[model samples]
Target: MGTATLLLPPRARFGGQRLSQSTARWLGRAHQDNVEGDPVARAFDILPRGWPVAAVTRQRDAGDAAGSAWLRADPVHIRPDINGARLLAHGDALGLTVSDADALLPSLKPLFGDAGFPIDAPVPTRWYLRLPEGAELPVLAGPARALGADLFDYLPDGSQGRRWRALLSEAQVVLHNHPHNAARVAAGRTPVNSLWFWGAGRLPDHVRSNFNEMLGGDDAMQAFAEAAGATAAALPERWRTGEGHRLFDLRHVRDLALLDRDWLSPLLADLRSHELDAGTLEFGDGRRFRLERGQRWRLWRRPIQSFVEQSPAGDAPE
Candidate 1:
């Protein structure tokens, strides 16, 4: 069996704090494709509007933090036809086309044109892994390590306790003042108006559903417990049965302050007093992360592009 790779840009992980060195690594390996435009442009036109989108760009002035922008116009979308025939089995699997590949190609071209990129082409806009129905899971980067995350170290151990781990980490690239998310925060729009990118993976559908339910609720703790139970029920039996070490679900929430361990532990405890769920709370260093039960950010994982320098001289400039 062969493996497929997905390349996503930083804006896909909207709410997380880490955004520089690691994002640079991924962008480094990225390249623009050379192909036709129609099918690829159609794909972009079809993406769900108001979702947090990420892409490497030749243009540094990409606007909109939660709105979509051009990534690349390269025709890499057609390369799978040459590299591997079976790669494009689904609409979601196709790479990018020439018209928009540039939008996603690393922004480094202005500084260094195609000197170190691996494959410069447009392929699919959204990167996903549609594994064979029952194939062995492919090895991929761990979520915490992927997003410059350092929050999973606090999970409680033992039979009655459960662990929550960061499944995927995405960083959102936003302008200093973009209206999409900012307007929503300033009472100009509601949380419902914000767009978010969440960790990528095949997870229980309820995880996302539970999060959406709390998007506009007043009682966050109550919403959190409901979401927690929903997420717990959605987990594979092994995870639910004391065999899991970590789990986390990112969603757009209202308050960032409620994420502190002290705040969450007590609230979680209070909620569980009525329900016998053994939920424990943990926190991440606020400098790089916000742990609120529901914040306007959901963890989204799409294909992220990282370029590998061909030679010492081709390396991206610091």
Candidate 2:
């Protein structure tokens, strides 16, 4: 018997009424539990040293600052509105390229250097900035939380926050007039407007995991697997025979319609054929449901309207 686990975002958005019928059915017959902690943190907990996003990702580039305080310096687009500005969306939605990154780095390097932080871009969309050791920095939110949300409330605080906020303002001004952004706008693409700082901290000394394999496109997942001495590979379209435990991250399936077509349907078929002994589904928001081969016989467990109920106002679990 083999076991597999799937990690995904919440099946539905906050206040969203439409339920994923197939997902609901799958969860209805499974043993469910609401795990506590950030999904990224939880995923890291599965690995040896746990979730050190900055350290693990920095290691991918063999960064000198891998052991130092570091943060993700990812490029982002910000749209200005009457009230204020908000993040455009995530990188995947921006269609950024290495060429874009190369063209922009030199122009902005001085600004970051002058601000006491040096930036590095090992990949097109992903960037890193090394901070002074023991520097007081705010507990900033990740890009996911600020995606499509107002930037004002999400900015840092205190004297350090003031400096960081000013740095962002200066960067935005520079990016707005940069020839690269002008060319981007001319080419009918969203301009690379600003930089987002997040996922801060140094790498952990050690890490561990229960799984033998981890399959996903997620950088953090792959990094964690590598650190934990597990076989990490790009996610495959179909499951292969394996022993021990495996984790599949499918958070890229942004909507229920695509989730059904790309993942749920195929996974359910695999379950029906007994190709798998057991499987678990985790919505990053903390809800986890486990399904075993024997549970398939529980036909009386009718599918619910939604796999997760709308979290109470101001009480939603992270």
Quote each prediction's TM-score.
0.20, 0.84
Worst 10 residues of 1 by lDDT: 163-172
Query: What does candidate 2's lDDT look like per residue over 165-190, in tens digits?
Result: 89889888888889998998999988
Candidate of highest lDDT: 2
Query: Worst ten-residue run, lDDT, model 2?
Result: 309-318
- Candidate 1: how large is its RMSD? 23.7
- Evaluated at residue 118, the lDDT of candidate 1 is 27
Compared with the true structure, what per-residue lDDT tens digits does model 1 show for residues 39-71? 111112122322111221211122221222221
lDDT of each: 0.24, 0.73
lDDT of 1: 0.24
Q: Candidate 2, residue 208: CA error in Å?
A: 1.7
